[model samples]
Structure formats: structure tokens, C-alpha cells
Target chain A: MEVAEKTWGLMKKKVLVIEDNADHQAIIKSSLVSRNYLVVCADNPSDALHYLLDEKIDLIILDLWLPEMDGLSFLKDLKNVPEFSEIPVIVTSGTFGSEYDILKLNGYGVREFFMKPYDPAELVETVGSLLKKTVD
Target chain B: MFYYTDPKRGRDMKRQKRVFLIGLLAAILGYLWELYLIHSHPPFIFVKIKPTWWMQWVILFAAWRIGVFISGLWKTQPTASSQKENDREEELKYLSRIYQDLSNSLRLEKGKFEAVLRGAPDGIFTLDEVGRINFWNESMEKLTELKKEDVLGKPYEDVLTFYSTGKLVGFEQGTMEGSSSSEPRQAVNFFSFNGDQSLSFLEIDAEVSGGKEFPAAVSVSTLKSPDKKNTEQIIITVKDMTAQKEIEKLREEMIAMITHDLRSPLSSILGYAGLLQNPKLCVSEEDRQKFLTALIRSGKGMLLLINNLLETARLGDGKVPVISEPVKIKMVLEEVAENLLALAKGKNLSLSVEAKDNLWADSDKDKLHEILTNLVSNAIKFSRSGEAVKITAFEKAQEVVISISDSGPGIRAEEKEYLFEKFSKIKKQGSTTGLGLYIVKKLTDKINGRIVVESQEAIGSTFTLKLPASKKASSSVQLSLVGSR
Candidate 1:
């Protein structure tokens, strides 16, 4: 375990957050950064896609509602790509809480779903566990 | 056994008894006359025939009695032909009464049916089996602007036309059974008149008189005979769907907007609060202050949205009482400016108030303050950084004119009309609930004030409020100024 921890320390896991709300973006970034994880913020899906093209994102935190293209469509497009399909995704929504939406997200291989006003501590814990499983 | 006696039969019996008594008396008199003739004549032939002649008199009496009895029987009994005539007369009378009752009830039922049709809210009409308009109600007359007399006995297709997807729908007799090869089956598929009592509702655009069209929901039910083989009549009810459709659309949009607006602020508040509560994370003093400020701001925004929603509901009832008093305009402006100073500073915008000393207006103090606060905050929210939001007040004739001007993106010409409408936001910027201007307009109207807008696109916009001035205060000020002069 000590050796594993050392190896984890050698390589930091990178997470991408796609959120339109500036305040939410700042809060999520601060929480993840405090946990020794690298965080990249994008205000929209297009910018998030640009980040994905430029970096190897290990995990993703997505907001369902967006300005240009909705998060579901972006997720679909991402899953179609061979490289990004394996990356774990955590979905967050402020307004969408229907069972149908959750089922669709589950079908798209989402690792976690969180409603707005969710605990940041829990989110950080989940992200850490998901990254650890990937490393193992 | 009970026996029944007729008065006419009793009269004939008494007459028959009197005839028999008379015949007996005549027989006795004839026998005496025969004896006297035999005694007086004393001839040989008369003596021999005396007894026999008396017998002949008796026979004559018997014959007379028999004839009277036969005549009495004939007078008492009725003949077959006369009895048949009497029975026919009674049957005719009974049939006439039944006919009278049936016609009366039918007339009453018709009257009731007509009254119900006329009182109905939806346009109701009935068509004959041949698709001619047989009955049109008052509502139908109002809906189509055509009188009953004009439409009665006319083909329904000629008067009313329906369209679906911009294609004309044909409505002919028996079209519900499916259309022919020459007709478009899709157009007539909406109708389901299978001689059943079931009703089918269809949404279509109905063209009225003068080629005016509106969305309508039409329901049709067929009346069939007992055998259900033929449709006797078709009852159609039309309801105008234009208002209902618009309301449904508005309700959907309102729900979406309200959910987005409410959750946005709530997310921010929760996020900031969560950050502040984290024990392990090292939050700098300045960062802590910023986080706390954001929390407060989000809380205030949520409260304002809730209050605006409640205010809209209250104002819908039109029961906001106005307490008119002499309110100092300058003091109101200063208070509004003080309240919105933080908001303006956040955006690096300056708020300035220009009002003469003791400038007074006769209005509701609380309402006036609320109006000014909303207008000033809106100006601050729209204005760019380093720009100025100016509030000026002056007296024009007997009215006080107050204008709030902002160096922001001015509204376009077409957009100005819907500036103060509920849920109408010209530009979706920041986290505005779009109820601010609507509340402002309602508050202004409640105080009997008029609002006007002056704007040039890409420059700035000014909202001017004209209110009645304080008469007594102005008169006193005029007197004091004259005395000083």
C-alpha cells in the first residue's frame, strides 16, 4: 500500500469540469485542487471538447444544462470517440432530476450522478475512489 | 247476479203491455157483437156460424198481439250497421286525443333542447344525415358570425372550412367511414363517425367568415337509430383553442424559466456555504470574505425573486392599497441610491442623484421607494463598468418628473413595447428573473403615475416617471420665495 501511495503521488490524476455557472466552477475547482488533484475548468461544451483534445483527462464532472450544446449530446459525442469512451464521467444537474434522464445517463456509462447543492466532500471522495480503481 | 236495465227497453215493455190489454178488450167486444148479430138476424146461416165467428174474433186479437210484440222487439234492439258506425266514431275520438298529447310533448321537448343548446358555452350545431346544417345554436352564430337562418338547410362544407397542416380538410357525409381514392385519406382520418355514440375530438384550424382563421378543437358525436345501421344526426361542438394553446405555452415557458432562475442562485449559495464549512481546506482571510459576500448575494437574489413572485400574485388581485402622502423626492432618491451602492460598486458603476432641496411629490412613500430602487438597480445591472447611472428630479407644471438614466445598451424600437411586460427580458444577461420591470410598471401604475422611455440603441436609455406634485407644499414655497423677493 505504501508503494501504491508512492506511485499515486508520482502521478496526479487530471479531472475536467464542464459547468456554465462561474461560482460552481470556482467552488468545484477549489475543492479538487485542495485534494491534490489537477482540475481543468470549461464554461461550455465546445471549450470542454477543446480541453479534451489537448489533454488526457482521467475523469470528467459534467453539468447537464449548457449554453450551446446540452451536456447529454456532448456526452454522446464523447462516448463515440474511441479514446474518450473509457474515461469515467460524473454527471451533475441543477434542474434535471427525472428518472428518464438518470437512466439515459446510466446507459451512457456514467460513474456517478449528483444533484445540485451536493456535498463537495463526497464529490472529492468519489473522484478519488474512481481514479484509484482506474489506476489499479 | 247484477242485472242492468236500460230506460229505453223499460219504455218499450210498458208500451207492449198496453197493446196486449187493448187487444184482449177488442176480442171481448168482437165476441159480444157476433152473438148480438146471431140473435137479431135469426136466419138459418147466421145461427150455424155464430160460435165460429166469435172464434175468428179471438184469432184476430191474438194476431194483433203478436204483431205488437214483434214491433216492440225491433224498436228495442240495434241493427248491425248502426253498431259498427258508433264504434268507428269512438275510435276516431280516442285517436285524436292521443295525437294531441304526442304533439304537445314533442313541442315541449323541442323547446327544452333549443334552450340548452342556446345556453351552452361552446359552439354547438347538428347536421342532418345528408350533411346539411339542421340546427345551429346561439354560440355557433357568435363563433362564425353567421345567423341561424343563413346557415339552416345549407351544406356544412360550404359555410365552415377546416385546415390541418396548411391543407384543406374535406368534411362530407359518411366521410368518417374513410375517404375515397380521389380524396386525401389523411385529412379525413381525424373524423371517427362509425354510427357509434362515442365522441372524437380533433384539433384543426377553422376558417370563419371573411377568411379569418383560428385554432379550434372540434368534437363530433353521431346519433344513430336503434339498429345502429344509419347515422341519424351528427352533433358537433367547437371550442376556440387559441387562448388555451397560448396559455399552455406560457405555462411551460414560465416553469422552465422559474426552475432555472431559482436553482441557479440556490446552487451558488450551497456551493459557497460548502466551501466555508470545509475544515481541512485552508481558506485565506480575503478569500473567506469573498465567499461570504457571494453567499449573501445569492441569498438576497433568491429572496428578491421569491418576493417578486408573491408581489405579482398580490398585484394580480388588484388590491394593493395606496397611502398617499407628501414624500420628499430627494430623500427617496438618496435612500434608493444608498441601497444599491454596493451593487453598483461591484460592477464599478457610479450612482448619482440630482434633485432640488425639498422636492416633494404626493405619492405612496413605500411604493415610490420600491419603484426607485428597482429602476436604479436595473440601471446599475445593465450599465457597463466605469459608466454612470444618473437620477434626476424636477417639476413640470403640476407634476414631478423623475428620470433614471443609465449608460447601458439601449433597447431597440420594436423591443421597447414589451419592456415592462411580465417574463419579458430583452437580453438574457446575468441572473435576472425578468420580473423587475414588470413589478416596477405595476407599482408605478398603482401610484397613479405615468412612465415613459427614451432610448437610442448602442447609446443609453432613460426611464422617466411623472407623478403629481405636492400642491400645499409648493404653494407655501412659492409664498416664501415671493416674500424673500
Candidate 2:
């Protein structure tokens, strides 16, 4: 059942990769490309915000840390934005377990948290499953 | 000598001396008569009599003999009396010595015990059976300001001293009852130590010895000194811990600052990623893809950095609860590799997994995941394009080894030593937070795992994680390793 759901959900799914490092960026893009995701890239918050205002984003794979504006702030702003209020944001970062930070992000309504250098297949599967749930 | 000081004994000695001289004269007369009789004896009795000079000499000799006999008897009399007196004096001396020893030992023992009690970070005191002060150490003195002399003999209610918030504590009825042996009751009382300094706070501990058999509410403790046999006594150890409590408050405040620092950037990246992913923005296809991709990658990267910071801080604070479970090595490796596969492929690197067998070890699942992911991710990060990264998991003897091999330039010998240290990054200048490997090491240690990093300059590096099959095994191995190295 999970396999069938994942296979079906993989069709025409969108994945957003938020990273500041060029090398990291290229790696994430390639991975999503292999998984057949319509991958979107952003180096910082400003460019990411511009894209969010324009695209029909299915799922947001948010990074906890970013240049200038951070992932959490970006999330909070997104929650406030009328068009993006209903979107699900999965918070991904290597920085986790800070009692203070986790609470803040949790308060801002981040659905899930994955540490960096994350699992690529799991990310794909999770993104696919989440999109399927939204479709259902 | 003592008799000399007694007038009655002196008078008796004088009377005895007079009797001795009279006896000497009578003995001399008797001796002269015997000589006279001997000279006048018949032929069968064949006796001879001495001349006047001889008689006189005999009398003198008899007198000397009498004198010696009298002196001897006199000497015996004094010795007999002295034996009785000496026996009494010896007993008294023994008692005095025992008293001195007891006092010295009590002082020394109390001194050492009191030193610990006073130095304890908690407040402590002892109340006698009657709730009186039988033994009060320096700490009690400083805490109550009532000297041992003042409170030693006073009843519990009368001399009971307690300083709460720098004020003398008042005792209520039933506070001084000695506990019974069968049902020992420790009248636990919590009080706040009021002081001008920041040491004002409530302390919690039971009154060790209740008012009954174990009276004195001595925080029931033992005193083991070489000179003194092991003895159970009431020893209460308390620290103000108020400073510690204050430190906790300060920690919470500092945590707030850290949260602010963490959330500001994390939220922005997430928010911007959400904004860019919205289709209503009508952005160009190429630009939109680029923007969304950056948003997600940065968001995940930022999240990872935050996770590392949190994990390290939690482990450092000794607040991380370790839940040991049967953890499958393949599961973790598979998960980590699958996650990093995209990144490796993006660099055109071959990310292979050599963990075919399902190797299981008892560990904290989350912590193990953290260690494995960090090692593999680091391997991928430092590797050049077209290079290969290998992750292998297998069991060797009693240990489970999870090794990550990379084709990147191996860590420098000098740098390898400090590679796992916090904020020590080989990537000199970049957006990297430098907490990845350090977090991994910390998490691994928490789960009682050994981490070995083998690197050669310009060659590939391999990070090996060895964890015991059981949590107990891990701890023992870790302890031995620590002791040996």
C-alpha cells in the first residue's frame, strides 16, 4: 500500500531545495532530479520569497538556517501570507534539539523536522507521501 | 609522703618510733642475760662467758640487729599502705587517659566530619535526643550563630537554633521527640535560608534520625576513621543550591537568547522557501526552479546546523535522556545513505553501501542516526566530483562497526586530532557551521560508542564507529578505553 501510494504520489510532484552553498545546492538539485521532482532552488530568503510569491508550490522543504532571513522567519512570514497559509512546511536543518529553537519553530507551525545531511530517499518518500495526503 | 601531710599519720609514726627504741633496749638486756647464763652453765652444757667489752660489743651488735629488724618492719608497713593508695591512683589515671582520648578523638572526628558537613553545598545540623546540641560543628555555629557552649546543655526547645532567611528559626511542639527504633520517624522540615547574599532558597532533605532511638536527628551518616571504629551518626549535608538554582534561571534566559538567534534565520529561510514555492507568484520557469531549489536546500542546511547546536548543547548540559533500544545498523545506514544519495549523485560521485547484513546493536536510535549521518555527509562534502563514498556496516566480534569511506583529501594529521572539536571546521571559509562532526561525536559518546577517524593527506578518509552490542557493554568498553588510553 505504501509503495503504491508513493509511486502514484511521485507523479508531477514538486520539491524545493533551500541551501546557501553552491556545492550543496548542486547536490540537492541532482538528487531531486533523479527522483523526478520538479526541483526549485533558492540561495537565500529574498530569492526564495520571490519564488514563493510566484509559484504553485506543492511542498516546502525548508532549511532552518539561511542567509539574511532564516528558514524559521521565512516560515513565520509564509504562515502570515494569505496565499501560502495552508501550505505544509517541513523544517530541515543540522541544528536541532535546542530547547529554545525547536519550541520557536514548533510554535510557528512547522510540521516535521529532519536533520541535515538527511536521507535522500526518505526526503523523496516523505515529500511524496505528504503531497499525496494533501491530494487525498 | 602523703601521710606527711596528715597530722594523724605523723603522730602515729612518732609513737611507732618510740616503741621501736624501747624494743631495742629490751632486746639488748635479754642478750646480756643470755650471755651471763651461758658462762655459768654446768660441764654438760659446756658454755663460755665473754668479758665486759665483749658483752658491750654483743649489746651493740644486738642493738644493730634490732635496729635493722625494726627498720625492715617499718619499711614493710609503709609499702603495704602505699600499695592500696597506688592501686586507687592508677585506676584514676586510667580513667583520665580514657577521658582525654575520647575527647581528642571526638574533637578530631567531629573536626573532619564537620569540615565536610560545613563545606557541603547544603545546610546541615544535629539535634540531641532532647533536641539539645551535643555536638555542633563549625557549620552549625556559622549557620545558627549559637556557640556550642551556649546551646550544648540547653533543651531542644530552649537552645534550638535555626536560621531561615538569616533569621533564627523557631521550633514547634513535637519537633524534639526522639524517634522509636521500630518505626523510625525523621521529622523532615524544609526551611528557607535567608541571607543577604543570593543564598536564600528552600532546601529539601529528611531529618536523618528521628527523636526516638536515633535521636539527635543527625542526618544518619557513618564516621569511618582509622583511630575510631565505624560508627553511625546523623550527618546532614546540604548546599545552598540557591546559586545553582539561580544558574538554572540564568540558563533559561541564555536559552532564550540562543532560541532567538536560531529561530531568526531558520524561520526566514523556511518562510522565503514557502513564498517562492507558491505558483501564484508567476515566476519564470528557470528562475522559479532555481529559487525553490535554493530555498529547500538552505532550509534543510539551516535546520541541520540548528539540530547540531541543539544536540551538542543538550549533551553538554547532561540533560539528554538516553533510551537504549535494539538498533539495526543497516536501517540507519540505509536511511543516511539514501538521504545523501542525491547529494553524492549531484557531484557525480558514487555513493555505495556495503552494509548487506542486518547488524543490530543496543543504542539510542536517534543518537546513532546522528553519528552515521554526520560521518556520511562529511564524506560527501569533502569529496571531489566523480569520487566515490562508501558506507559499510558490519559486526566484528562484540562490536558493530559503521565506517564511512570517502575519496576526498584525507584530514591532515594535525587537524584530525581536533576534527571533532566544536566549531573546528576543515572548510576554512564557507557557510558551514562546523558543528556536524562534533555533534556526531557527542551523540556517539552518549550512546557509549567509540569513533575512530583515519585520514591521510590527499588520500581518502574513513570514519569508523564502534559501539557495543549492549548499552552496558558499551559503557564498560568506553570506561576501559578511557582508562587504557
Candidate 3:
């Protein structure tokens, strides 16, 4: 049996929030900040692509609708890359049509989805829970 | 006709000639009668010598001159012919202008009506009681992709069958099937169809009347223009609410996405936070417990958020069903109190439920339990340490009122409007999930109950839940049905 490697130090997990709406971005930021997580905001898919290339993103908060390229395609493109393929993307959308779009995103290995008017407390708790589950 | 310069205007000259002939004849006849009297009688008896016809004619002409002088009756019409022609022309012009003005306004009104009908988004069609399509609008033509030639005068059922499949589908079954011989009105039915071209859903509401049926689904409401109660024809207005539906769809998607996305990384954060709570990690005992407590708090908060999202969705779609059955309220209350005891203990609040035996209600067990749990938990959460959380059950004539009152600072008058609204909580100096009261009210309403609030902001708030006398009536109905069977 291969011996399992263990690390003693706590690694800060980086969160990439790809949302088109500015208000929604603010909500994600405030909740993640309260939980003491490093959150990065990208308002469009192009910016998200640039961030993914430059930064080692641990998880993603992706909105399904974005200008030019949407979050679903962004998720698919990132997943296609060997190094970034394993990153979990949580899809968020404000419309029902976009929700149906998220179902397609799920096939791309999205972890979960958050609808807007989301509770700030729930956002914090869910993020904590998702991160905790990953570590375990 | 009298000779006049303009012969068409000879009408005035003819009238003057008729009057002159009558005057001359009358004067000549009067003179002849005087001459006969003089020849027939003696000198003393006979009338004095009377003027001849020519003398009388002179007198009549003098009288005519005097009338013309006083009233100017014979003023020139530029010769009477021109006057008559001018008057006739003016009258004809007035009549023509009135006719033109009326026709123009009528045309404008018709054009306005046609414009409105064409521009309206809802497909409007008129159907007879026998289900014949009599009138179809431009919008209706576009909506069904059928031209007026194809649909007008065809039976609606035939159209529905042709569109749906080869079989006849009894399109009017819901509305027409339920008439008792004496049942006054046909029941209205609302139906929805998703078009094949795109998945756009069309809602149809139809009504039947006086054998002249008018059914349109957009509003699903009877048209208000013609009073079905009095008028022969039923006019229905179909309002296209596609924009409204789109907005609602957008809202639903937003909620779903936000909730889903928040859960992903939140799980990771919570997982790491929980790891610190392990004593094996060499963390201090106090630190371990603190992290664990924080983890639990965050988990609860997240659950509360998710519950709010779900509740909002359910409320909008009207999908919440009230499943009521005979269940003991006392048992439910006891169970709620037991579950809440631990939370109450933490605050040192005396949580107790007061109920009488044999108190039963026919209600959805799950919903009742939820109502009780929310009230009890809210009472314990809001109360100060050592305060009391009381649950009391009593009966009114048709309902049983269950009240949960806490001694914590109650709701204020200003906050009362939003007390049961989603995410609304009393501003307390502590951690709280404002969804409990909202769930309480919503669940209560589902079970056909009312919630009354009694509160003084500084003292505390009391929530009284009223449930119907469902047990007796529902049980009897079930028994009667079984007996009939």
C-alpha cells in the first residue's frame, strides 16, 4: 500500500467568484469575508479565464449568465485544462432559463448552485461546509 | 312657372305670382257681387254705386305697396331667382358638412379599435357555445400559425384535435362535463399549453354563456365588457402576461443559482473549521469546543438560508398542499417541547407546554409540528436567560387556539408589518435566523388557521395560532362516505 502524505500546515483555500451582477458579487464578498476566506471576484468570463491562468484557484462561484462568454462555458473550458480540471465550480443564476443552463453545467462537474436573494449567513455556512467536506 | 332671369330660381317668382292671382280674383269677385246687388234692388234699398273691378284692383295694389313699405316684403333677391338659388346652396352645404364630420369621427373610432386589437399581444378568439370559432384576431392567427381562412367557422374541438393529434381530445370536457340539470352556470376552467416552436407556455381561461361561448386563457377571467348576467354576448379580454412570466422565471433562476453556488466552497470552509475542533489536532480544549460551536452555528445559519429560499419558491408556485388528518395537538406540542428543551436549557428558560387531554384536530401533522416548533424555538431564542417560554392550548367555538408567549422583548409596532415576512427578525442583540416566524405564519395559513400577535416591544411577544375544528367534521364526513359505500 502507498503511504498517505500528510501536511501539518493549514493551506489557505482561494475562491474565484465569477458573477456578472455587481450586487451579487458584493453579497458573495461580504459573506466570504465574514468567514475569513480569500475571495476573488470576476464580473465576466474573460476576466475569469485570465484569473484561472494566473492564480491557483481552489473553488469557483460562477454565475451562469455573463457578457460574451457565459459562466457555464467558462466552467467547461477550465475543466478541460489538465491542471484546473478538478476545481469544483458552484453555479449561480437569477433566472429559470439560466437554471436549466446550470443543469448542463452540472455535467461539467459543478459541486452546487446558489440562487440569488441567497441568505448571507447560508452562503457563509455553505462555503464553510463545502470546504470542510473537501478537507475531510 | 313665372318668368325669372335664372329659371332655377323661378321658385320664388312662382310663389309671388300665386299670391297676386289670388288677390286679383278676390277683388274682382267682390266688385261683381256689388254690381248685381245694385241692378236687382230699388234705388233706396240698393247699395251705393260700387267701384268696378279695375277700381278694386287699384285699391288692392295700394294695399300691397303699403305692406311692402312697412315690412320690405318685396326686396330684390338680385331678382328672387338668385336669392332662392343661394339659400338652397347654403342649406345643402350645411347638410353635407354635418354628414362628412360624422363619417370622419366614425372612421377614426373604427381605426383606433382595429389598431388596439392588432397590437394586443394576447391571441383573442371568439367561440360559440357549440365550440365553433366565429372570430379570430390577428394575434390569434399568428399564435396558432393559422390564417383566418383556415380557422374561421371551424369547430374549436376540431382545431384542437388537428393540432394535438389525429384523435378527438374532448377539449371542452372540463367546463362542459359538470352541469346538473338545475346547475345554473358552467364552471370556468383554466388550461395551459406549451407551443411546439418554443417552450413558451400559453394559459387559457374559458367561460360559457347563453350558448354564445367566449373563452380566452390569458386572464382566465370572464371578460368584463358584456355582463354575462344581463347581456347576450360575453366579451372576454385576454391579456398577454409573457413579460411578467419572464420576470418571475428570472427571479427563480437567480435564487437557485445563488443558493447552489454558495454551498460549494462553504462546504470546504466548514470542513476545515471542523477539523480544528478535533482534540487530536493538539488544539486547546476551549479552542476546540469554540470552533465546533462556530461550525454548528454556521451550519444552522446555512440551513436557515436554504429554508428561506425554498419557502419563497413554494409560496410563489402555490404548490403547498394542506394534508390534514385527525391528530392530537397535545401529543404534537409535547414532542415539540421535548425537542426544544435542550435549547431552552442553554438559556435557562423554563419551557413548558400546557394542554388538555382529548384535544384533537384534523390537520397536516407535519405542518402543525412545524408551526409548534417554530413558535417554541422562537420563544426560547428571544427570551433572556431565566425567562419563561409558555405554550398554552385552549378552545374557542370552531377552533382551538394555541399560544406561545415569551418574556423576551416582544415585537414593536413598526416591525409588526414585516414580522412574518421572510428574513425579518426582531432586532435583538444576538444571533438569530429570522425565518422561524415566517414559517410559522405560512404553515398556519396552509392549515386554514389564523395567527394573532400580542406584544409590547419592551415586554415580550405572544403568538396565538388558531386551528379549525377539523376533527369532528372530517371524521363524520369520512364515516358517511364509508357508510354510503
A-chain TM-score of every model: 0.93, 0.83, 0.83
The weakest ten consecutive residues by lDDT in model 3 chain B span B476-485
Full-model lDDT for every candidate: 0.78, 0.61, 0.61
> Which of 1 and 2 is the better model by lDDT?
1
lDDT by residue for model 2 (B1-485), tens:
21122264444454455456656665776566666665654522434444476766676667656764565455344467667876787799899999999999999998997688656544465543334445655655554456667766564445442222222223222233333432222233322111211222323222222221111222223333455443223333334344566667666654544553455345445444543454433345675565565555546655766787778778779898888888876667778777666556545678777653456798988888777877877787778777888877666788888788987878888888788876663453124455788788778888999999888888889999998874322221210000000
Range of the 10 consecutive residues with the lowest summed lDDT in candidate 2 chain B: B476-485
lDDT of 1 by residue, B175-252 (tens): 222244322322332234552577766787787746567789888888887898777888889898889999898887
Sort all candidates by DockQ, best to worst: 1, 2, 3
- The residue pairs that clash in candidate 1, if any, are none
lDDT of model number 3: 0.61
TM-score of the first chain in candidate 2 relative to the native first chain: 0.83
TM-scores for every predicted model: 0.61, 0.35, 0.37
Encode model 3's per-residue lDDT on B1-485: one tens digit a residue. 22223366444555555455544465555555555654655543544655566766665566544433433244443557767887788799889999999999999998998778666777666655445667677876655566778877886655532111111122243333323443233333222211211222224323221222232334222222243332222223454445666667665655544544345335423443534533323445564564454445445545545665577678668888888787777778888887666557545678777766667776888888878877877777678777888887766787878898988888878989988976563446333445667778878888988999999977998999888765543221110000000
TM for candidate 2 is 0.35
